[model samples]
Target: MKTFTIKDNVKKFLTVLFWILIWQVVSLFTEEILFVSPFKVLPKIFENLGDLNFYQNLLSTVLKVSWGFILGLIAALFLGGLSYRFKVFQELISPLILFLKSVPVVSFIMLAWLFLSPQGIPVLISFIIVVPIVYLNFYEGLSRVDKSYLNMAEVFNVGLWKKVEYIYLPSVRGYLLSAVELSIGMAWKSGLAAEVITFPEFGLGALIYNSKLYLDTVNLFAYTIMAVVSCYILEKGVLYIIRRILK
Candidate 1:
């Protein structure tokens, strides 16, 4: 197993190197006209890594998106539980869920801009993108839970909190985990899109947009790399927290 794992890691590294080689070749041809070489981009990334401002921008975006994610997740679980218990509420909410699912995220950002502060736009957009996904995912999981276990609990007069703790959470754990994983990525994407459009005083998106305005390709790519890396790290961190909580 250890040998296989080492070989797997090597293969992944080689695959990444292959893509970087391709990017370098492409950059050689286009660097004069558009984006710069990976060598330049990499140095820009490191330069930013040493800057206090980069950390502040990253923290700003992370905190905004994290708040949106937590709010959306809590709202989804609460509403989903209510929906599971009441058929009428589910039926009433179906249209709203469908509407949220159907609307383009760009449209949400544009409309939200008219009323919400620039700082609030990303949060709203992220929340909008997250709610339907987690709600529907959790609802499906709840609907498919084993009725026998629930009935047995009811017969024994299990307390509401105990029933949720022992039965519902365990049964829906997989689905909730999957939903959260999926939604956090979307939340980052949408939240950043909001930031780009809104151009709040601070954020990865704001820096990205400012770079574009100044035609600074190196900074643009560097900021983009930061955002992508941040998104990846945030997803892993959220999963770690969820697993610990559920355990």
Candidate 2:
């Protein structure tokens, strides 16, 4: 087992190294202004690390995306639970969820920009992007709840709180985690896109837009790396929280 784990780690490292090498070769062949190597991007990342506005932009983006995602998750839980109890409610909302899912994200961003402030556009777009996904995942989880367990709970006259804590929650735990993991990426991507289009006063997206405007490809790559790394950290943090709660 230890050998397999070590081998897997080495393989992953090799894969990353391979990509970095390819990136370096490509950058070398391209114009310096248009493409920068990994070495250049690293310095750009560090340069931004020392800037207050960079952190502010990053925090703004994170806050906007996180708020939308968290709100969507909460709504999904409430609606999923209610829909599980009321078929009519589910039927009524089904089409709305489908619409949200089917509509292109850019359409939402453009439409929302008309009615919302630049600051709120990202939040609204992220929320829209997340809602249907979480709703579907939560609903699926609710449907998969074991009927035998519910019947036993009813036979024993278990209270609502107890049933929720012991039965409903456990049934939905996996689905909720999956929803969070999946929706986070969607929320971040949609939120950033909205921010880019809206050009909010403060956000990573704005910084990215500015980088493109200035033709600063190095900073653009750096900002992208920062976003990817930040997203990964958030996902890992959520997983950690879930594990701690489960324990």
Candidate 3:
């Protein structure tokens, strides 16, 4: 196990080094305004760490996206349950789910602009993006539960709580975890994309667009890095908490 871990760490290091080298080569060829070096961008990102606006925007994005994600997950589970219990509901909602799944996030953001407040846009977009993904996954998980176990439980007249404890929860745990993991990144990305277009008063996306507007390529790259790192951290943290709960 330790040897495998060392090999995996070495592979990751080499992968990152290869990308950094490519970035450095590209930056050398391009104008600073177009593509700043990763070294320069790293310092700029650290500088933002001291800036209060950074926290405010980061907090705002976090709150909005978290709210959206929770709402979407709940809605998906409720609707998925209904669909699983009644085939008609699934057939009726299939097209709508497909549309949400197929439509571009930017397109939804643009359409949403007509009615939604800039602040509300990111939240709504996140919710919209998350629902179909989690819904599909949860539905699949529920449907894929072992029918033999279910039949045996029925034959033995298993209590509702017992069935849920031994059957339903175990069956859906993987799907739920996977769904949440996938939806977290999508929700964050889609929320940020909406913020970029909407230019909300506070968000990493607003910072990114503002940096571009002012032609500050270093800060532009910095803010983009912050967004990526923050999103990745949130995904790991949420999954950790969720795994603990599911256990």
State the lDDT at 215 in candidate 3: 99
Query: Which ten contiguous residues of candidate 1 have the minimum total lDDT?
Result: 28-37
Number of backbone-clashing residue pairs for each candidate, in the order shown:
0, 0, 0
RMSD (Cα, Å) of model 1: 1.3
Ranking by TM-score: 1, 3, 2
At residue 168, give the lDDT of candidate 1. 84
Model 2 clash pairs are none
Per-residue lDDT over 1-247 for candidate 3, one digit per residue giving the tens place of the 0 to 100 score = 9999999999999999999899999999999999999999988888999999899999999999999998998899999999999999999999999999999888999999999899999999989988999999999999988999999999999998898789988999999999999999999999999998999999888998899899999999999989999999999998998899777
Q: After superposition, how far is residue 166 of candidate 3 from its true place, in Å?
A: 1.2
What's model 1's lDDT at 49? 98
Model 3, backbone clash pairs (residues 3+ apart or across chains), number: 0
Give the TM-scores of the predictions, in the order they appear.
Answer: 0.96, 0.93, 0.95
Ranking by lDDT: 3, 1, 2
Best by TM-score: 1
Q: What is the lDDT of every predicted structure here?
A: 0.92, 0.89, 0.93
Mark the 10 consecutive residues where model 2 has the least summed lDDT.
238-247
> What CA RMSD would you report for each candidate?
1.3, 1.8, 1.4
* Candidate achieving the largest lDDT: 3
lDDT tens digits, residues 12-99, model 2?
A: 9999999999999999899988889999899889999999989999999999988888787788778887888999999999999999
By TM-score, is 1 or 2 better?
A: 1
